[model samples]
Target chain A: MASDDSVSLRVTPLFSLCQELGARFTPFAGYRMALSFPAGTLREHQHTREAASLFDVSHMGQIVVSGPDRVALLESLTPASIRALPPGRLRYSMFTTPTGGVLDDLMIACRGDDLMVVVNAARREADLAHLREAARGHAADVALLEDQALLALQGPAAAAVLSALAAGVGDLPFLGMGPFALDGVLCWVSRSGYTGEDGFEISVKATHVEPLARRLLADPRVAPAGLAARDTLRLEAGLCLNGADLTPSITPVEAGLGWVVGRERRLDGQFPGSDVLFQQLAEGPAWCRVGLRLAGRAVARPGAPVLDPQGAEVGVVTSGGFSPTLNQPIAMARVPAALASPGQPLAVRVRDHQLDALVTALPFVPARTVGRACSGPSEPRNKP
Target chain B: MSKVYYTEDHEWIRVEDGKEGTVGITDFAQAQMGDVVFVELPPVGTVLTQGEQAAVVESVKAASELYAPVSGTVVAVNPDLPDAPGTVNEDPQGEGWFFRLALTQPNELADLMDQDAYEVFVAEAGESAG
Candidate 1:
């Protein structure tokens, strides 16, 4: 569907099915998307953690870059090593400005001939424009695949549910992508998702999305999840939302995304903002992104000012919310590097009074992504 | 039965006696807020003015302010909220009472809508928000 704000909202192919299942619709990124089903956000959040949930993420922008110099062109826009990425694998990268600030975080999949990029819906227009400029500069071809509908089936039971519907899906490794057929309809399946749970993101033709979703939902283990649960899931997983966590002034090093930048690229210093990024790497950023475990139940949402023990403003919370899995309030903030250590006491000015908070490690809940060991440094469980 | 009155902000006040009343959000408010995870109540003996921010209700996705329905002094608050805030979502009108306010101007109750009028107001709000 076409994207426009003044005109009617763009509808996903599964819109009617979601309506039939009693979904509450909300306008998101110029599309009418399901906020939650009749079971509500809480039930949907818990269900996905306990079992499995299907999410309609068709509003995101999916693009394909091809040509003889495709990898070279893609590498110019992002800091990640696009030329080194192996086929059938996905890498999480960001389009950075010359000043090292993030334009958008995206998942790039190398498919031998062309590279597929999945970008955030809110930044779709800007990302496309950026891609066009890069293509013009490098003489490459970029096409937005508007005819595809992307769906994510996530949770512990996600693999089983997907394997039952499509063969060869269960064997895919984490961050793996390949062509597959669901009920004889050609689709591309990736063994990755934003929930930090073992799951798959399936891209199918718009016309085939409804039947595929309905067939997958027929299993007792799968339930329809919406944007509300998705946001909480990602927050609990310590994943960054594009606009909130990664902003125009926040660099990858400052956002704890140094792992995404390849070492070879770091040594050669060829990408955008490479000089500044190298300097930041040598001397840590002024502010480092850290996770905060709030003392009380009062949620510290985004824009809340983070303060030190002496009532000095140290940082600002980028993403904060109530964690359904942890059963407490958790937040991510960008604070001075000196006070970023775990167990450091901090205060958050939520509304009127300052609430006590502790600087803790990220991923409020431990991630259970399949075939991947927990990446970050191991920390004690349940400190707060 | 105590007479229930509603504010334009969707807060409900049930007058228990001539001088004291209880305040809480209506079922419509809680439903719209999704899951209630935390509730911040005004301390006892705090003086409140009509249409002023009195308490805070935090859900999974958002935090909403609960306004004072009538001018009063908070005499009591629900003690079960800190440990279990879902009580507001389970039974918002009953055990979910936010606080007991001793009315300073009982005549201010006339400014609120009755149950019937509140239902009509809620319908209009739903239409506008939708």
Candidate 2:
């Protein structure tokens, strides 16, 4: 179900600019998003790892919960320590079902009195409905920020590029958020990105997004990237894609996202599906997510079978691609926890070929974020 | 002198002796499929039928099959493609050729579109697909 080719398509604010820059359009979550620019996906991916890339992530759903009870309402929705987060801080979280399955993964940023939550494009409608239904008699004001556009400027050189345009941007911590003036344009910027790079995700008004995009593209270190590069970069970072690696039937514990369930939430158990999740935490989920380094040059597309050493079908590949950073094929799979140890031998069935693969550590390409403790490339750990 | 013919699938054959031709995907095809990371060309002496999948082209986004434009036997593949598959995206119609084929049914060429006809086909296809 990774196909985002919806029947009808709407264009984003930067759609025309993307076309002018020689973009290949792919229908994603009902929007005609660029799959890649003239530089292509591979080059754009490499460029982001080295310099910086400007991605028009306008299609992502931005919802802001503002009011006296905004923080309380958000705390009741997810398992992250939202109540404990100070202003201008961000936390990665997910909505879990009563069965402990993940409904959707979202980014929650705490503004002074408002909580800004960014959900995946495909799950936006459902997420909005769920939030609204939960806020019937509550004091929280649930509204989608459709009037705003989200742009991600990511890579190792991302800070240098943004610091050149905006003041005080380089001072923000890894998950810090604040408002900054860029050439007279006000923008809500966050020192974070999905690509595991030292970058910023800027939320700006729809009418003002194009000029800001142009100004950023004018920088020699910044180039246009697209959804394809976005997907590959997240894969390299070992991030899960909702509807693929995560779904309503896949719990966060099983998805190897136990990190999102903070210690306070684990004891209080106020979130949905706390019972099933607590059980899984004490025991273990039958199937768990694992990082893999494929043997050959071909990519192991999602839905490809994962075979045990004895050639028995044991798992399924959730996400995969040729890692431009690693210069080899890598994939993530859901397999038995017993088979998920580091250096465990396995094989992936891609078309008519069965390539030998090993259970490798995630974040195949180490993250280079600023002011953050990034994991080493070969750090062998059983934890997520 | 060799002459070129085109297929609706955006494949091209440069026929020199009318019985054998060098085959490669058209520039439009390469552009349609982003940057090619791998091209799975058939081995020499492999038999192919017209409209059959003769090779696989894997881009960063997805993989697609390259259909044979006419029936032929694989003579040789571009030796440089395995390591430098980006050539298919850079010079798709020239040195980036996929393979050479000895035509089994040469008359199948007549059913394909000529250069002018293909230009028109690409125009209409691009408009409709876009």
Candidate 3:
């Protein structure tokens, strides 16, 4: 574990705010994180639906690409078209290895000058090296924002919550970013989140995190949430975890993220792994990622083998759990192309028992448009 | 006439008709583990020694091992827990009871703590240090 190392994972300025709000703490990616609170995961999940919740996402890696040619330099690496991204707009992009597998999926926001990229906590070091090597001597300077803390306030009342705390915050729409003072603390505010809800991600200096978090959480609708609820929330929303759902072994197409690949970049063939991606794009991969809905009460956990009617192993589950929203076991698996069809009958081998499961369309929970142009949580229908 | 005893592991046992006892977790255990969602009880005929896990209590966070206060053979289980797990949190000592066991040896009761001692122990144990 990273805990055994001398250097500890950095805590966000909102750590004290989380403690004051009654968050249950646990270790995640070397950082101590809240698991849930007195209300438990169920209520916390509901709170996001009925109101709003705050999450301390300081563990995520934030880096700034500055100097001339930064956009074009970053554009050469990710599949998402960074050069065309308007100032103050954010886009989801993935970094690919030489073999065309995903190194990591990240959110890149283009400011007037510098390019701000937010990545998964677990992949921070590797992502930094990948970007550094690509940007080396390319008129770009990579600066990691280690002194800043990242916080996410998400759910139905997110805009209202920010509107109550800061001026001009309510004006920022989805994927929009602007500078503002939150509770007298200067910070960068973005109307974006991972939970498929209307929300804002705030970047503040380390010292001001706690006070600002408390001020925002003072709203009656806001509650302190943890990683447990966050995981379930993102899973229910059909968002993929970097290491679990994506890896260097899987390409963007195989991972169902073909849309993020910019068309111009494909024709130009500048980025690494472009050849493999082009090939896969032309000829569909043999195996593709698909959503799996179990038939019985049993849950098909990660690493559980997927079998056909003849009981021959065909695929493996990468992420699975009992979704609080759907009220049944749901999973994402990499199965044979033939068995990846919606409504196809398959079985997940749990222990010595074979639980009946079915192949369902990805994003089992259909994205709904709640108020404020935010995509609401996906709800996968239960079979058992 | 019978007596109920408690263990530091959060289990409670009440002596029944000679050599038989009813076992379940205390109210403190349920409270510490927010909402009780599932319980895995031992089979009726299964025999268990003292300190062995008698049942499994799972909440939203994770699953916990429920140890036995006294050695015994399983006799009955609460069928109501599978569908209505909140019963255990509402009444860990009554309708939410886990199982009945036929005590293998009556002398094992000496190792358990009485209600009064268990109360003091629970007070100092804090929340979920286990």
Candidate 4:
């Protein structure tokens, strides 16, 4: 394990605010980010599901790609249909290696002449290098927004809180992005988030983030959450973390992210690793990502060996944790494609024991993202 | 009142009658772990050696090994933990006791730290971590 002293750590603009709110710091992507607040991870998870929560996500890499050939330049690096994306719409995509491996997964939002992209903090430098290399000889300029601070307000009550702060924010559709002002502070607001909740991600000047975060936290419904709750929230929502669920060696098809690849791109074989990805899509991947519902409370953390029915190691768990919402241990693992069915039986090696587990459908808890009407019952149907 | 002893790994054992002892993680340990979601305890009658892995405690963030502070045989394991593991975070020194052990060598307790020494050790550890 790498110690904090091994790397120089940076702090977000809201670092002092986090400290004032009783945040426990943890080293992440070379930044001293908040791991959890005094309310704890379990409570923070529950609070985010029930109410609104604010997160400082400034560590992520934010860049703007502009010029007449921006879409074409970006398309050469990613498999997404960048040319077809309309203004104010966000699309999740991945930068692929030549050999069908995922370089990094990112969210790209079209802003008329420019495209705004958000990449993982850990892979920011590499992603920028990759984009620069791909944009060579193209009429595109990639500008990193170093002075921006990104904050995400997430949960079922996010819209209500945001709309209260800004009148027109509630009008933005899911995955929609546009310029908005929060108390006269210019911000780029996106009605999207990683937690599968109805929320908005606001990008503003670093100088304005502290006040904005403080104002949002002043609301009774909005609590300050940290990286700990963020991870569990995404895991419960079946969302994959970049380094955990995705790696340079894992293709989009194997990671169950083939939906991000546009149909035309898949057929044209134009993007990097398109040949390998097309083959996997047509012939099926050797191993695929699946959700595991452990029989007991023991959690099968990342790197835990996933065993077949015969007690042979078949694959490895990429991410696992106790789902506070489900009140049980859930995990995401890459197992043999044939054994990735929803009801297949498997075992997860948790320490000295191989605990009983079953392959289940992703998203242990149903996502309550906005734009979808809450027509059904409010209570969850399946009990873990 | 029974005497309480602590280990370098932050486990605490309260010895009663010099034979039976109740063991659990220290309050400092639980605080550092953030939240306790699951705990795997040894079965009754399982023999444990001092400083060996005897149990597993997990939180949403990570999993940690719980080493036995003294050589003993597990006499009883906490039954309430499976349903309410948060007790470890709520009251780690009291209701959250992990298991009861029958000491095989009571003399081993002499090597452990008492409350005062354990407090000093924890202070030093916290300083280094900070």
Candidate 5:
């Protein structure tokens, strides 16, 4: 099943840094990303849990939309309420197809006059096209800033480690964005990350990426994390990966992202697939994504068949793995709406093995951020 | 001396004590897989059919299926190897042995390639990669 083609993609500026750390590099999203360091994936995963880990996510797209009509122009393309977002706040939004299917999920942060967007590295081209097409009739402008490198310094001690590199970072609340100086380099910093931990996503110029990464890694708490831990971490956090858990055919509503579509946007009914999403919201989706904890040690991997009490095929596992955090097998499945309820028992057949499983609330790990409580924007939360 | 045999799938088996056999992935196979992280061992006493996947080995690169070289009942599995998956890289033949099987038919070893032929196969694979 392996390909014979020898096609090496462009390496990031931190390629040598990863190698110096003895990172096991693997091809991902057209970039050679570290799968784990010399400590191995298990330790790398554990290290991130205990302290901090530096991730080179520079391959992710970082774009800026400026001009007077930036907020309005951006709101037309995404389902989130960008116009309502106060300056220095970030919102999770997804680009949708004409029919309202999600093209990609991204983070949009408002930086005063300009809007900073971070997108999945794999969907850079399609997301850019969607932005360009939406910008055609708008009053604002779009600029894809290829020069910015995205770096995620994540874990419990992440704030303490990053505070040393960048000043005034300690004051920034979760999901809040502001400009900061790292090594005298002015970069857009957002208090957000993929790992279900409190962290920061710093957008710096590509040239300054390596130096900042090194400075951050110099702290004893931070180890170089690769895609393997990243995947496991995100999965434990109950986050859905783009190609695996979502695609253009899956709408945001069906993907459990109805909250992103602001109340105003939902009422306006101008966004793509608004009618279908609204209807689905009124009457639950035919199939909803649910989390499953395998009854036994058997893993229910993606494409594995799900059976009912009578052994009839009911659904398929969209994403499944051994959750290092939970110390057991877990999975996400697109099952019939009736079985989507939490605490329901189900069976997953893997190679003639019918393993018992139970539906549970997503985010095997509860979000540790200061979010979920504050209905309002991230700002105005003063630190003690 | 215990005789060693190899399968085309890059697995090596060493028959010992007449009917008992120790199975492991070859060194060449481990090198091709890069860094080994997790080794899924078969349950002790589970009967495995020849050429069927009896266990799994997951490296940092990808997860691979380890085929049973000879049909037999699993007798013992190396429990230490899971916590120290790097044993597969450190000693692919000794401590990294996946499991021991009580062979149902010792004659199946005749179907596998001998050490010399296995070396030739590994050499050819290296040449193909080059």
Candidate 6:
């Protein structure tokens, strides 16, 4: 929806390479994304669990914030404690509205004198405008890295594959970022990713991405993965997608992302929606996000009505699909806080029938991310 | 061997005798559907009308409805499908058959496309869709 109806969709830096791999392209967030490959999204998903899978995340927006007042200006816009962020570490945070609604979720990395912010592709245009406008007369400068491409190499074998191409890449701590040379090409690599795996998000120039991607793909343990597999992998790890789960009406507390709000900023939080978010955190939100395990094979899609045991509509599903890892139907829903528990009985209305659903603990698959080592797409390391 | 008839929705029916037919999704449909995860089939002896929804084939990404190609009574369903639907991706036209029909309106077969016409139909539809 970001692009005008008459405008043509843009392709990523790896578009031609994806095509060479027999990728089926689909329009995604104004970009021509590779939805799946010849092996299919499901097959790519299972392969990532056992080996490494490279995902072209060039659609994501990367912004560089530099200046003495950058941290102050940014902290004033969100609940993150930017002042406490040490250099070379990544922090997951969100941009919120005055009424506690989420605008978008993002990853903020402290890169010495500057900060690097990666936001969702669908919200990039808005995020850029918001950042530029917010900086205004402040000493902070916001600039989009237009020539850069972001690629995520994820899975259990991700570290080994990357380490083979770049020595010492495996030693970077989880959520840490620094300069690394992949086959002698300097790139900023971070030990972070959306898939709950021990992986790296490599930020390289657009010209270098294709060759780097090809280099990784050349590994027997690494293969090209597409957006479809990325979605399923994140869902199985209980990670929320931007448009489906997080929205302008959903608060961090209600979305089970209270930790994303800096704990140190609680009493003195000054960002938009701080009061509302802190109040909900204290009293607990009336509605809370939860994971659902469907009884039958039928997938419970997003927007399906969640019903209570007495057959009354209690909540709504925000994200749902057939989890390839679990080989069963799974979903995420916003239900009453009282019903947000492990093993709580619930039902989802799919088409005409009500399928029995149970409230399961999130991260249907266990997270394998490195603390100082490696991991998978995740449930925010809550250790569920 | 029986002459096979195809539907726009991607179902196929092979009729050996005028009244008896085996129904399943076409190979083109299976390839497009991706990895089959689970399947839901109507019970044996269920009566179906032409174009009526008779079965559901769920893939990792979505669920697709398999419609009855011609009005008939479902005398049998592939017993192995519900437990191992991935067979649909492997042998969609053969071992992956969904149901057998005792046709009530065998005349409905004339309205569907044959192999040659269906190939052209699929080709044009795919071109327009892509």
Number of the candidate with higher DockQ, 3 or 4: 4
Q: Please give the DockQ score of every candidate, comma-separated.
A: 0.47, 0.46, 0.25, 0.56, 0.26, 0.40
lDDT (C-alpha) at residue A13 in model 5: 76
For candidate 3, give the lDDT of residue A271. Answer: 82
Best by DockQ: 4
Give the whole-model CA lDDT for all candidates, comma-separated.
0.87, 0.86, 0.78, 0.88, 0.79, 0.88
Model 6: lDDT equals: 0.88
Error of 4 at A125 (Å): 0.8
Q: Ten consecutive residues with minimal summed lDDT in candidate 6 chain A? A: A375-384
In candidate 6, which residue ranges exceed 4 Å CA deviation? A1-7, A372-384
Per-residue lDDT over B1-130 for candidate 6, one digit per residue giving the tens place of the 0 to 100 score = 6899999899999998797999999988887778888888899999999999999888876788999999999999999998788899999999999999999999999999999999998888666545
lDDT of 5 at A271: 72
Please state the CAPRI-style docking class of candidate 3.
acceptable
Off by over 4 Å in 3: A1-10, A295-298, A368-384, B1-18, B25-36, B49-58, B63-71, B88-95, B105-130
Return the lDDT, model 3, position A194.
76
Ranking by DockQ: 4, 1, 2, 6, 5, 3
Candidate 5: tens digits of C-alpha lDDT, residues A1-384 = 232222566677788888888775667888877767767665677788789888889888888888887877777777778878889998888887666678888888888879988889899887888888878888777788867788988888988888887768977878888889988899888888887788888888889999899888888888888888888787777787887777777776676766767777877867777777778777767777778898655556788888777788898888887777786778888788788878888899876678888888887876666554242222221110
Q: What is the lDDT, from 0 to 100, of the residue B8 in candidate 3?
A: 82
Residue pairs with backbone overlap in model 2: none
lDDT of 1 by residue, B2-107 (tens): 8999998889999977689999999988887879999999999999999999999999868999999999999999998888889888899999889999999999
| Higher-ranked by DockQ: 1 or 4 | 4
Per-residue alpha-carbon lDDT of model 2 for A9-93, expressed as tens digits?
8888999999999887888888999988888899999999989999999999999998887866776778788877889988888
lDDT for A330 (candidate 1)? 94
**lDDT for residue B14 in candidate 4, whole number 0-100:** 99
**Interface root-mean-square deviation for each candidate?**
7.4, 5.1, 6.8, 2.9, 4.7, 6.2
Residues A53-139 of candidate 3 have per-residue lDDT tens digits of: 888899999999998979777877877777667798778788888888888889898888798999998889988998898887598
